[model samples]
Structures are given as structure tokens and as C-alpha cells.
Target: MEQRLSYLKQHLQQNDIGMAFIQGKANLFYFTGFRCEPHERLVSLMVFPNAEPCLVCPNMEVSLAKEAGWQLDIIGYSDHENPWEKIQQFTSDISFQGTMLGIEGELLSFSRAEQLKNAFPLTEWTKLDNIFMDLRLIKNEKEISVLREAAKLADFGVEVGVHALQSGRTEMEILSMIEFELKRKGISEMSFGTLVLSGEQSANPHGKPSMKTIQKGEFILFDLGVVLEGYCSDITRTVGFGAISDEQQKIYNTVLKAQLDTLEMCKEGTILGELDRKARSIITDAGYGDFFPHRIGHGLGTEVHELPSLNENNSDVLKVGMCFTIEPGIYVPSVGGVRIEDDVLITTDGYECLTAYPKELQMIK
Candidate 1:
């Protein structure tokens, strides 16, 4: 945590930013090793260029923050108290005129921004998103270890979902089973809403699970991830409930080939855009280009979706220690959808497949 804070302080000094107010939960955890959800309350980390940093949170969480290894000064406020006023009191001794203040503009609410403006009326506010993104784009050994564990849990989630599949089972029923099993294993949160779209509903990329019963000879799509140790893992697998048709098999094969081919290119210095094109071209050649939508992947870490978007238009270069997902799908409104996704980490040589779930088409009996 100290090293991360030092890096941020250097950036502030270089950019002439006197102080930075980081409010994003992911970022707060990144810099302070403390994860918190303040909901409507104000929770932030105040970082200075040459001075010690301070954490601000509700008085109730002050002890919790200290327990999380935050050894710095903490400014705790009550619900009836104005947090901006508390922040002002803390910085009253520091000079603000002709100096710039940095903030997470993307995550700051309008009302909070207004309050901040009133507190530091003479100070200029600039975005600190790029600084935070640059700091978090790469993962360390500890982060990778946590991610690997999360990926394993994600694999287990798909395995449970596959086993719960039945000819007469509804999507929600299977979805509930998956979560219940995860809870038994001590997983407290999911990266996103558990997706268990079956049959025609599977054709909708972001469809919601319903009470509709799944039938044999249809496709069942399971897209889910578990949050473990402050890291996240995402995996998507589509399986056949019973004997599927020729067209469905062909579509599934095309998606599998695309994902495999793209994974082979997950090496250092590979352009992010080319990975998407590689998968897109294969699906297009198979005559399902239009059916294949969305990017090839996205950066996975503290947040389910992070930096370095893997799209056809992204020109960012892949580097070692960067982890992301490789998901390729073909959805046909008339024939259901087939998607295969995996969590991967770029290594010194090539890449490591974090999620170990089988990629081949599975026919659940």
C-alpha cells in the first residue's frame, strides 16, 4: 500500500497537483488496502504531493479501516455532519490558491462535486482517472494469486451450473442452485448478476434469467463470476441440454475455434485490436459475423470490467501481468446463442489460462 501511494504522490508532484481526492471503492482499496462500500455516505482517500495521506469515512467504520492496515490519520464524520466541512478543517493549514486538486471525476457525484467546489472555491479540480488507471492496469504477484483463486471459483460455478441443468429446470432454479453452492463454499458476492439464460433467451447477450423452463435439445448459457479476496473472475460457458442440431453444433464449433485462435495470440506486444479482429474474422468467415457482437474482452481485476478494452478499434499493446477475459460468441435469434469465455493472464512467454473449465461443447444429461 505504501508503494502504491508513493507512485500516486510522484504523479501528483509531476503534474503539479497539490492533493487528490480518491472516492472510487476500487481505488480506495488499491491505494489503502481497505475495501469499503459507503453507499450514500462519503468515503475517500486524500493524497498529498509532499505530506502524509488521510482517509475519510463514517465514524462507524473508523476502526474497521484501521483493522484493514491503514495506519494513516483518519477523519471520521457522523451522518448529520457535513463531510466537506470535515475535509476543509483537515486542510485548513494547507495552501490552495494557484494549486490544482485532483479527483475521480468519473465517480464523483454532482452534489459531491458542488460541495467540493464550495469547500475549495479557489482551487482548480482536474481528473485523476488516468493516473489511477495507469497504476492499476498491471497486476503484481499477489494480485495474480488472488485472481487465480477467483478464476478457480468461477470454474467451479460453471461446473455447478452444468450439473444443475435438467430438461424441466427453469433458468432461475439453476441460477439459484449455483449461488447456493457458492455460498456454501464461503463466497459472499458475485462479480455481476448471475446469468443463466436458456434456449431463445440465450440469444439475448444480456438477457435476464426468468421462470421459463429449459427443455432438452436447447442451449443453456451460463455467464457468471465470483468476487474473491477483492479480485474478480468472469467466465461464460454454453452447454447443450440434450442432443443438439447440426446448426447449433456448427455455431458452437465456430465460437470455440475463434476463442482458441485468439488465445494463441495473447502474448507480449500483441495489439489489442488484432485479437478482436482475429476472432471477428473467423466468425465472419463462418458467416456469423453479424451475430457476433461485443468486444473480444476487457481488463479484469478489482473491477469486473477495467482498462485496456479488447475491441477491434483498441490499439493498446498487450503486456505481461495484464489479465483480461477472452469471450467470443455467436448469437442467432432463431437458433439460440453459443459463447465461450475464459479468464487469462499475459505471461512472459505467452499467456496463462486462469479459468480451467472445459471449452469443448458439453451435452448435459
Candidate 2:
């Protein structure tokens, strides 16, 4: 955490930004090694170019912040107290001139930003959203290790869900079973909502799991991930229940081919657009061009969706140690949909797939 803070301090010094108010929960946790959801409270990490960083939280969370490894100054306040006043106390102690202040524009609400602006009326505000993105794009060794373990649990999630599948089982029923089994293994939370879509519902890319029953000869889709040790994993798999039709098999094969072909091209220096095009081309040639709606995939890490989105318009080149997802899908409105996704780690020569759940079209009896 200190190393990350040092890097940020260097950036601030280089940019001539005197102070940075990290209000985003993710950024706050990343820099301070502390995690908390300050729902309506004013929680922030105040960092200056030369002075030590200070954490500001509710009075109740002061001890929790210390337990998270923050050793610097901590300012706590009650619900009735104005947090900005306490924040000003630390700034005044540091003799903060507030010439140039940085903040996360994307994560900060307008009301909060207004309060901050009022606090530093003379300071110039710079948005550090891109700076944070660039910093987190490449994963360190420890992060990759945790992500690898998270992927295993994601794979396990699919395994449990697939085995729990049976004719007449409602989508919600199977979704509940998957989460219950994962909890039995000590998984306290899912990275995102567990998705269990079947038949026509699967055709909707972001469909919600409902009481719709799973029937034979239809596609059952599972897209889920688990939050393990502050890291996250995401994977998607679709399988047939009992027997499926010829057209259904064709759709599934096309999606699998697209996903596999695109994944093979995931190596260092590969352009993001090239990968998206490769997958889109394969699916387009198979005559389902319009059916593939969303982008190929997105970057996955502490948050499921992060920087360096894999799409046709993004020209960013893939680099080593970067972990992201390569998910390709083909969704037909009426008939059904098929999507095969995998979490990939960019290596020197090629890439390694973190999510190892099989993508073969399974026929559950």
C-alpha cells in the first residue's frame, strides 16, 4: 500500500498537484489498504505531495481503518459533525496551500464535489480517473495470484450450478442452489449478481434470473463470479438440457469458435480492436453478425469491469501481466443465445486462461 501511495505522490509532484482527495471507495481502499462503504458519510484519503496521507472516516470506523494497516493520521467524526471541517484541520496542519487539488470525478457525486469545491475555493481541480485507471491496468504478482484463486472458485461455481440443473427447476431455484453451495464452501459473497438464464431469456445478454422453469432441449446459461480475498472472477457457460435442436447446436458452435479463435490471438502487443474484430468476423461469417450485440469483453480485476475495455473502437495494445476477459456471444431473440467466456492473463509470449470451466456444449440428462 505504501508503494502504491508513493507512486501516486510522485505523480502528484510531477503534475504539480498539491493535494489529492480520494473519495472513491475503490481508490481509497487501493491506496490505504482499508475497505469500507461509506454509504452517506464523508470518507476520504487526503494525500499531499510531501506530507503523510491521512484517512478520514466516521468515528465508529476509526479502529477498523487501523486494522486495515493504515498507520498514518486518522480523523473520525460523528454523524452531526461536518466532515469538511475535520478535513480542513488536517489540511491546515500540513499548511496545505491547495494550489492544485485532484479528485475522482467519475465516482464523486455532484453534491460531494460541491462540498469539496466549497472547501478548496482557490484550488484547481484535476480529475484523476485516468491516472487511477493507468495505475491499475497491470496486475502485480500478488494480485494475479489472488485472481487465479478467485477464478478457481468461479469455475467451481459453474460446476455446482451445472450439476444442480434438472428439468422443471426454476431459474431462481438453481440460482439459489449455486449460491447456497458456494457459501457452504465459505464463499461469503458473489462478485456480481448470479445469473441463471434459460431458453429465450438467455437471448437477453443481461437477463435477470426469474422463476421461469428450465425445460429439456433448451439452452441454460450461467454467468457468475465470486469475490474472494478482495479479488474477483467472472466466467460464463451455456449448456443444453437433455437434447437440443440442430440450429441450437450450430449457434453454440459458432459462438465457441468465435471465442476460441479470438482467445488464441491474445498475446503481448495485440491491439484490443484486433481481438474484437477477430471474434466479430468469425461470428459474422457464420451469418450472425447482428446477433452479437455488446463488446467482446471487458477488463476484470478488483472490480468485474475496469479499464481497457475490449471493443472495436479501443485501440489500446495488450500488455503482459494485464488480466481481462474475452467473452464472445451470439444472441438470437426468438430461438436462443450462446455465450462462452474466459478470464485471460496476458503473458510474454501468449495468454493464460484463468477460468478453466469447460465450454463444450454439455447435454445434461
Candidate 3:
């Protein structure tokens, strides 16, 4: 955390920015080692170019922040108090007129921006989102370790879901079993909603689980991930319930081949856009181009989806220590859909596949 703060401070000094007000929960945790959801309340880290940084949060979370290893001044305000006034009082030494302030423009709401403008009138506002993205683009050894564990848990989730599969069962019934078993293993949160789409429902990429019953000779898709120790993992797998059609087998093979081919391109110095193009080309050649809608993958770490999106237009080059997903799918309207995904980390030689729940077609008899 200290290193991250120092890096941000250096950037502020270099850019001639006087102060930075960071409010996003993920950004806060990245710099201060403290995480909280202050819904409707103002919680931020006030950083200065030449002065010590201070944490501002609700009065109820002061001790928790301290326990999170934040060794700095904390200004805790009650629910009724005006936090803007407290901020004004705390930053009295700094001149607001003509001063440059950095903020996350994407995460900051319009009302919040107006309040900031009123609090520090005449200050110029700049975006700090790109800076944060650059800082978190590469994962260190410690982060990779946590990601590895998170991926293992995600693989376990798929294993449990596959075992719970049975004919005539509702999608929600199997979905509940997956979460209940995860809870029994002490996992309290999922990175996203657990998705259990079956048969024609799987044709929708972002379909939700429902009471729709699972039938034989159809596909059951499981897309899920678990949040472990502030990190996240995401994996997707589609399995056969019983005897599937020949066209279904061909679709599954095409998706698998595309995903594998894309994974092989996950090496240091490779262009980010090429990964998506490779996968898309393979699927298109197999006559399923229109069905593959989304990009190849997205970066994964503190958040399930982060920087360095893998699409056909991204010019960024892949580097070692970069982690992202490589997911390819074919969603047909009436037939069904098939998607195979994996969490991967770029290495000097090639890449490491973190989510190892088998990609081959799984037939549950």
C-alpha cells in the first residue's frame, strides 16, 4: 500500500497536480489497504503532492480502517455532519484557487462533482482513472498468488455445479446447490451472480438462471466466480446433459479450438488485439462468425473486469505478469450456445492457465 501511494504521489508531483480525491472503493483499497462501501456517504482519500495523505470515512468505520493497516490521519464524520465542510477545514493550508485536483471521472457522479466544485471553487479537475489503470495493469507476485487461489475456488465451483446436474431439474435448483456448497466451504461472496443457463436459454450470452427445467440432449452452461481475499476469478463451462446432436458437437469443438488457439497467443510482446482476431477468425472460418458477439477477453484481478480489454482494436501489447480472460462462444438463437473460458496469466515463455476445470466436452450420463 505504501508503495502504491508513493507511486501516485510521484505522479501528482510530476503532473503539477496539487491534490487528488480518490473515492472509488477499489481505488481506496488499492492505495490504503482499506475497503468499505459507504453508500450515500462520502468516503475518500485526500492526497497532496507535498503533504501527508489523510483518509476520510464515516465515524463508525474508523477502527476498522485502522485495523486494515492505515497509518495516517482519519477524519471521521457522523451521518448528520457535512463532510464537505470537514474537507474544507482539513485542507485549509492548500489554496483552492487555480489548484489542480485529480478525481475518478468515471466513478464520480454528477451531484458529487457539483459538490466538489462548490467546496473548492476555482480548482481545475483532472481525471485520475487512467493513472490508476496504468498502476494496476501489471500484477506482482503477491497478487498472482491470490489470483491463483481464487481461480482454484472458481474451478471448484464448476466441479460442484457439474456434479449437481441432473435431468428434469430446474436451473435455479442447481444454481442454489452450487452456492450452498460454496457457503459450506466458507466462501461468502461471488464475483458476479452465478449463471446457470440451460438449453435454448443458453443462447443468450447474459441470460439469467430461471425455473426452466433441464432436459436431456441439451447444453447446460455454468458461468461463475468467487471473491477470495479481495481478488476475483471468472470461468465458464458448458456441459452436455446426455446424447447431443452432431451439430452441437461441431459447435462445441469450434469454440474449444478457438479458445485454445487464443490461449496459445498469450505470450509476452504479443499485440492485445491479435488475440481476439485469432479467436474470431477461427470461429468465422467454421461458419459461426455472427454468433460470436463479444470480445476475446478482459483483464482480471482486483475486479473481474479491469484494464487492457482484449478486442480486435486494442493496440496494447501483452506483457509478463498480465492476467486476463480468454473466452470464446457461439450463441445460436434456436439451437443453443457453447462457450469455453479460462483465466490466464502471461509469462515470459507463454501463459499460465489458472482456471483448470477441463475445457473438453463433458457428458453427464
* Best model per TM-score: 1
Error of 2 at 125 (Å): 0.6
Which one wins by lDDT: 1 or 3?
A: 1
Evaluated against the true structure, the overall lDDT of model 2 is 0.90
Write the residue-wise lDDT of candidate 1 on 1-365 in tens digits: 99999999999999999899888989999998888778899899999998899999999999999999999999999999988887888887654445798999888999888888888888898999988988899999999999999999999999999999877789999999999999999999999999999889999989999999999889999999999878999999999988999999999999999999999999999999999999999999999999988999999999999987999999889999999999999999968998999999999989999999998999987
* Best-to-worst ranking by lDDT: 1, 3, 2
Off by over 4 Å in 2: none
Query: What is the TM-score of candidate 3?
Result: 0.98
Residue 154 C-alpha lDDT in model 2? 91
TM-score of each candidate? 0.98, 0.98, 0.98
lDDT of 3 by residue, 1-365 (tens): 88888989999999999899999888898888887778999899999988889999999999999999999999999999998998898898554346899999899999999999998888898999999988888999999999999999899999999999987789999999999988898899898999999999999999989999999988999999988877889999999999999999999999999998898889999999999999999999999999999999999988889988998999999999999999999999878999898999988889999999998899998
lDDT scores in order: 0.93, 0.90, 0.92
Native-to-model Cα distance after best TM-score fit, residue 202 in candidate 2, in Å: 0.1
Model 3 misses residue 316 by how many Å? 0.8
Off by over 4 Å in 3: 94-97
Query: lDDT (0-100) at residue 176 of candidate 3?
Result: 95
